[model samples]
Target: MNTIFLLNKTKDPTLSEWYERKINDELRALGIKDVHCKAVSSEPMALEITHPLVLICSSSILRDTYSYQSAEQVYAPHAKILAIIVHEKVKFFRHRFTNLQFSPLRFIYNPHRMPLRELIFHLLSQLDIDLEVRR
Candidate 1:
């Protein structure tokens, strides 16, 4: 079974809900039947989950130093973590990339501007997962 954890720390409930529903829908479309995915608001709750995980978290959640460290400690070395930062231009994220310490990490800037399939493919690629849907 594959586990995908979406740590939504965004204050906007609407955006968080969209991410959860869209991501899960795409997973289902790809025939990931044994996949377990969830959107969690709390860091401690996410940390307690024991599985080889793929984590997608908003940068707003990690803006606080403690929150970022907690995330690094929890998901580092075990999961493929993707940090999303909303910006006007995707290139802006490059300036901030040096600060992160986590390995197996990827970045998604201005996710709203990207196609859902593209985003899903990027996440699956990071985990080296190939999905085949039987429609």
Candidate 2:
């Protein structure tokens, strides 16, 4: 089965939990049973993440470079990653520099610009996961 690792290493606990639940609920509602979604606050040391789809859902991830680096070290070199910008308060300079550090891995979603459901669908499509939406 395909797996999704939702990484949220921010200071906000509630936001982390909310993202976890929301993503899981959205995937469940989509009738996507083949993919397993797991949320983690920090780098998972115990679990062996085999080329899973990773989602970085933290507002301050750009500010905390260590977390990003740690994640890079943990996941497979070819693993697909998507960073979701939960907040837009990151300074211009910081955002630019931090983005440079996150080379190759692009920020795919900004809640202010697009809905989470849209992002999810886009990701699923990219993975070639075909499923009929249940009304």
Name the best candidate (by lDDT).
2
Q: What tens-digit string does per-residue lDDT give for candidate 1 at 34-115?
A: 6656666666776665553444444443343534454456454344365543422333345554334333343443654556
**Per-residue CA lDDT of candidate 2, range 25-44, in tens?**
88888787786566655555
Off by over 4 Å in 1: 50-80, 83-105, 132-135
Show pairs that collide, candidate 2.
none
**What lDDT, from 0 to 1, does candidate 2 have?**
0.56
Worst lDDT run of 10 residues, candidate 1, spans 97-106
Clashes of each: 0, 0
**Cα lDDT over the full model 1:** 0.54
C-alpha lDDT of all candidate models, in order: 0.54, 0.56
Q: Tell me the lDDT of model 1 at 73.
A: 62
Best by TM-score: 2
Question: Residue 120 of model 1: what lDDT?
Answer: 65
Clash count, predicted structure 2? 0
